[model samples]
Target: MNNEAANILLVDDEPNILKSLGRVLKNYSVTTANSGPEGLAHALTTRFDIVVSDYRMPEMDGIMFLEKFMAIQPEAIRIIVTGYADLEAAQNAINTLGVFRFINKPWNNLEIINAVEKGLELKRILQENKALADQIRQQQARLNEQDAILKALEAEEPGITKVNWAPDGSIILDESDIDDDFKF
Candidate 1:
């Protein structure tokens, strides 16, 4: 695990709710957003590893926030803490937003921390995967460029010699390898 602390975003329209959750997660790096649109703006610009949102809010509900958040930052792990667990809303959260978990209102501090920790773990794994994928892509590009150079060297006229190194880092051809048809 990384020694760095987790970056958490607390989103809720109610000032009291945001303050309470912020206090609960005081040990970590916490950023608060008051509305869904405000949260979206912050999330798009900020670098948060996880987002915890209240389900009931004016202007935009948790569901809508989740949707917008997923579009902008798909790797972020999300949790919905709501006073009411309507089956329809729960289903929508799962199907549309792919929320990591759901918590009932009046949550336990320990439980919230645990969920946030789990979300951070998942985010780390995703970041690692993305880095590995980018490395592979760069390596492939380098190989392609090398291949092009090798092809160009090979296409030289008969008078030119194109020599390469062996896997053991030894030159494949010395002066003796040159024949009447090819010159160094």
Candidate 2:
């Protein structure tokens, strides 16, 4: 639903499943990988906003693949699409892999679509929040620097309570500015 099309990666060893999922996510920029290793390779090369992987795969399961994927791209939203209804696997996907959602093998088209949309939305929010957090850190650093400068200025002129600068870039210090009663 976002104006910017999200890049999605769908991984499943089954060709038909990959095709079907890709077709369902036609609105998004989709990449398909046949195996966990292949998917991880692609993930390393390209940044996907959302990744949907089947639970059972050769060499690496969905949980392992998603976990490794997160190591490479922690910002990417992960979703597990599994035919197996293993509660343990679902819990592991959520707890270990930080999966956004888990959809059963015979996923409803609308449900899959909704899940992908929600994943993309979460990705967008995370990116925005990260940007905002970086800005806050930068501002805090600047504020700290300003505070240090003010402290240094006060240290240099202990008696001076107020400093007025003229338009001509000259400092105006008056006798009344001296806080004689104040002790540093």
* Best TM-score among the predictions, by candidate number: 2
Candidate 2, 32-57: lDDT as tens digits: 99999999999989988899999999
Off by over 4 Å in 1: 1-5, 157-184
Q: Pull out the clashing pairs in model 1.
A: none
lDDT of 2: 0.87
- Evaluate model 1: give its TM-score: 0.76
Off by over 4 Å in 2: 1-4, 161-184
Per-residue C-alpha lDDT of model 1 across residues 1-184, encoded as one tens digit per residue: 4414677789998889889998888877889999999999998788778899999999899988888988898878899999996888888888888898889988898998888888888888888899999999999999999888777776875324455879998877666656867873
Task: Say which candidate scores most in lDDT.
Answer: 2
